[model samples]
Target: MLSITTFILLGILGLFLYLLVKYPDKSIGTNERPDLVGPRGLPIIGNLIGIYLKGFTNFNYENLTKYGPNATSTSLGFGRLIAINDPECIEYVMKTNFENYIKPNLLKEALNDVLGDEKCGDSNENWRAIYLTQKIFVKLFEEDTKKLLNIMEAKVQSGETFDLQQLFFRFTLDTFLKITFGLDKNSFADPEEPVRFAMAFDSVQATIDGRFLNPFWKFTEIFSEGGRKMRANCKYLSEFAYKIIKKRRNDPKALKNPKDILNIFMNAKLEDGQYLTDKELRDIILNLIIAGRDTTAQTLSWMMYNVMVNPAIEQKMVNEINTLLSNEKPIPKYEDVKQFEFVQATLYETLRLHPSVPGSVKYCLGNDVLPNGTPVNAGELVIMSAWAMGRDERIWGADAKIFDPERFIKDKNGLKPSQYKFVSFNCGPRLCLGQNFATIEFMTLTTSLLRKYQFEIMPGQKSPPDFGNSVTLPMKDPLLVKVYRRN
Candidate 1:
């Protein structure tokens, strides 16, 4: 972080540079809207030093709460940033006027390095069709889900304390690969043994996250060790993808599940009737991995922690699960999982509090006015902070910060979040393709865990909800816990 003195010096230099160049203003050659409120700052890097000082989560909260649940702006040297939390404004940006808000240059720069390793389509019509049509084989994931339960059973029998986040990471990784790529090469069976591909993929996530926070990536990236690590990790990930693609091309078993995601994509034809190139295929799988992996695991970790923190909620959810499985002790199938509304509410509540994707940045493709009466200019970046939105008092009443699943349970429509309110899966054109798969994966694991085991948060851990600066919000510290068999 830049010191206060240094920030002032940079502000002076920034103003000098601002005088040399001309940039468009919102109104009267200045942005001084009462509705669009934020802390006053210099000509460029507006309030950035303050943001850096407070950290991302705190910065978001301060702005959203202090400025009201509307739109606020902070102009950096490169571009202007508008932080928006209002649901109506969020809806406008996410859905109503979706085309106008594309991923900004900052996001592009952060993701550019790994783009070529090319894992996932940028969600064109063709990509969306293939993604939405592909039915994830639930049986495959359920089978792996059992393996995860068995592993947990082992931990309990051995009386061992464990990091819940690491466990979920391995489970989600394997489960995602199994359904998406028709592969079952999970090293979560022995997490301590280390999986090169998994570790490398994780490195890619952290490295990408680092870029988001880096204002000097354009200059510093070339000389930094983090940059080198990012490059190496990208290579490792691409090579790993290529190897799977190669193996699957020759193996008939890859098509064993007719609805297999990879098989469907591999067989899919573009508008020109040409099949997706190897690069495209690799990218698609990579996209699925990113979409499916950390988000669920992190959300699961948060759900567990929140439930542990509030035991009555956990008991109520377990009761709901038990009611659904009253007659038979068999594992809940896809249809059966739907009956666990309370379980869903518990998870949804967690999402509201600690959304896996904490914040999103979208570039304004055209000038437009937000519903809250904030006029935005073309080329400015708009940051939609789900983390902050979930905590907005206007949206959720005074107890917005409270982890109360009952809010969702009573509302009936709460689980199906209204447009911008629950954006964990996002909304509109760019909503997540893997939403169904993720929900089922969580249900299968969560429901089964509740059926057989009782979880307790282990003592002496800080339990600070410090989120890592990744694209997907993960706990910076391990969530240690102990488990016992239910009678």
Candidate 2:
């Protein structure tokens, strides 16, 4: 029996060897090709042991730099996952043959539980709707939300100490819902507000956490913990959207010609001169809610933490706000916020230090070779670690880790950003559509707080909020802020 078992194992090994020798492109071994092999991994499990043990923090970027950008591959599972760190190689993948790489099915499956079926999360047709609505309506109408800004400023002026992260998250959530869905679920003021949509938003963070930690939760497989929550959330969100869709479809009187995202969508006609389905509109609304709420909230959390840690920079910002708004009326306009250059720099520096979306995963559409001569197969997963890339010494220079906003003011050639290097909003066709809108919101919110209250970190507290993985990086601990109302 033992001899027979040994014979079978040896035969299988021999077959694998034969395949590699016959077709080098199909196998894991090749000297002529740049393959990233670290230490030996177990069969089936592959290098999951390393990934599981290291988890999030154990992900070593230094190892990649030492091994040439294209030379090293991280063993994810059945396939060898390629890691591309070089800026030129990233440019090639993101721009050169942009369509050849796309968001993997796994991501879509995971996000679909939260994002809905509209393909709004997709880079294609649905995204076009999102881009049009956001660019034309939301971004263009920066001043239209003055009423909302007035409310937030009033709340701040009343002298309440609040968690800026949660407050801003709720603010954006409410703003996005009103802007996109025409529903004013003021989640910030009333925490117990039973907005079914807020519950749906929770699925995004959980799914993001699961994507990094659990390998079993593939896109197609729906029984995973995160997947289950996502499906539930989607069902609720869809039902709620269907109600609105029914109202809009059945009753033309219900459709308000108000200047909001949904109103524009109601009027939108495709290139073929056809109207979009109710499901399409709902999906678009849900996508914007997720995008506007989580990304901006997380970015603000990191920014607030940075302000607390770097008191000098924080004071500079406070001084700028006070000096600018001192003589003027307390209620500042959106244009008034633009003059505070230090605030802009601080936000840029925060994005540099802790980008909301650290990495993006793309699957090769077909066979392609990276700039470093690493061949990527059609189905292999390519991870572009934005966090690692942001902190890359080659790009950011010697004081990469330091919280200095001046770096953005000057580039490596001693000029401004060369268009590709500072990619917090990404680049190319897939660049963030709501970039200007988000910036406006961020600066406005920051200006609102800076002009009045001063946030100082409590003694013996960790300066920057402890970062952990979710759809967006948020505070592991509540960002405890002590507020002193500045006249």
Candidate 3:
């Protein structure tokens, strides 16, 4: 006679076996293209186990390199994924046949909670109309940079090691909030509201990344502790966004200024001649926050890490900034930043090695052949590995792994690479509208800091920090550094 516990255990094992047998490998159907090459997958589960163990960025780069210089195909249990690293293929998919590929429904569903159902909007007009001028950008961010420098000065005076990455995240969040909604979040001071909002924002982003790996995340989210936390975080973040929207709607003063990005959206008319709904405003604001905050912060963090690790590179950057501007005029004007060729080159190099959005996925709306002759079927996924492309020896050079800013500097001006090749800002029609703004911000902040302070990586810290698994390429560990005042 079996005991109750024994019976339950046996039944659970039987159910697991039943699922394995009942579900056929989804990627093994007629849609599987034999010409494409990749790692062999196991029964039912496919390469998900491998991806889980190896990490997303590493797994994609390793397999894509081994199986292809152009493209490779694999399955992640749910469906077939064709990973493309070739520039020509990327251009074809992102540009020539852009209409045929769209954000995957699975991805949209995962992100919909935080980002709302808003596709990229026509932001160029808004940017041009209000904030494109050099003076506006300098005016908008100068005070924020000063605040940041003051905080770093405090750290320097304390003679304590700190995580620059965390500081950068907070700094960018404050600056972006100020520009986007005309609200000074003061994240540098680490107030309760802004800190809590930042934590919730980051937690929700990590949860969304997890969703991409697990097909039955909906069910898991109900029963798991992590899922419950994710739900709570999402709720908090939503409330935060809506609260801002409600406050802005009532503030007639907000309309008169026309300084922030929110006012532009709020006042604009749609095709239907109606003002944006509160929900639309929430979506746009949240999306912009994620874009403006994470990308800039993470890139700055990585750039600093790279500069610290390479002393020669750091010296060159310091000399360039110092020569261009002095303590008398420390904070760079937007035009002054344009002249700091070495600083700009360093930024481009950092982005090439550690793109903020390391990779992007597009769903094929119809069957099509890529420029590289890779056949992608409708319902399949095209995974463009920006990280892989950046590191690829064929695309860059034999010394692609080495950090070199000279690659971007030609005759003392920034060399413009093909959008497909240097795709940190993305390529084609969907090129980031904030490209100019982000560049100016990067150069401005970087020039300002290097002018006054020097950085050293804390002892025993890992060389070339490991990348975290997130929508953006964040350092896995806090980028701890010892700050020093420049003589």
lDDT of all the models against the reference?
0.75, 0.65, 0.81
Name model 2 segments beyond 4 Å from true. Answer: 1-34, 37-40, 53-71, 74-78, 117-162, 191-196, 218-228, 253-258, 412-416, 460-463
lDDT of 2: 0.65
Candidate number with the higher lDDT (2 or 3) = 3
Candidate 3's C-alpha runs over 4 A off are: 1-30, 190-194, 410-414
Worst 10 residues of 3 by lDDT: 23-32
Residue range 1-487, candidate 2, lDDT tens digits: 5798899999999987775565344223322224454444444444566666654332535445555354333344325566667777788788888999998776776576556575433435544555555544434334334544454456556655456666666767777767776666756456435556665666556665666656666653366565676667667778887787777667676565544666666766666677777877777777777777888888888887888777788878888877766535543455565677778878878887787776677888899888867788877777776667677777777787788876765645432344356667776667777776787778776776677666765566566456755766667666656566565
Which is the leading candidate under lDDT?
3
Put the candidates in TM-score order, highest first: 3, 1, 2
Ranking by lDDT: 3, 1, 2
Residue 118 of model 1: what lDDT?
A: 44
Q: Which stretches of candidate 1 lie over 4 Å from their true place?
A: 1-35, 75-78, 115-136, 251-259, 326-328, 412-414
TM-scores for all candidates? 0.88, 0.81, 0.92
Write out the backbone clash pairs for model 3: none
Poorest stretch of ten by lDDT in candidate 1: 20-29
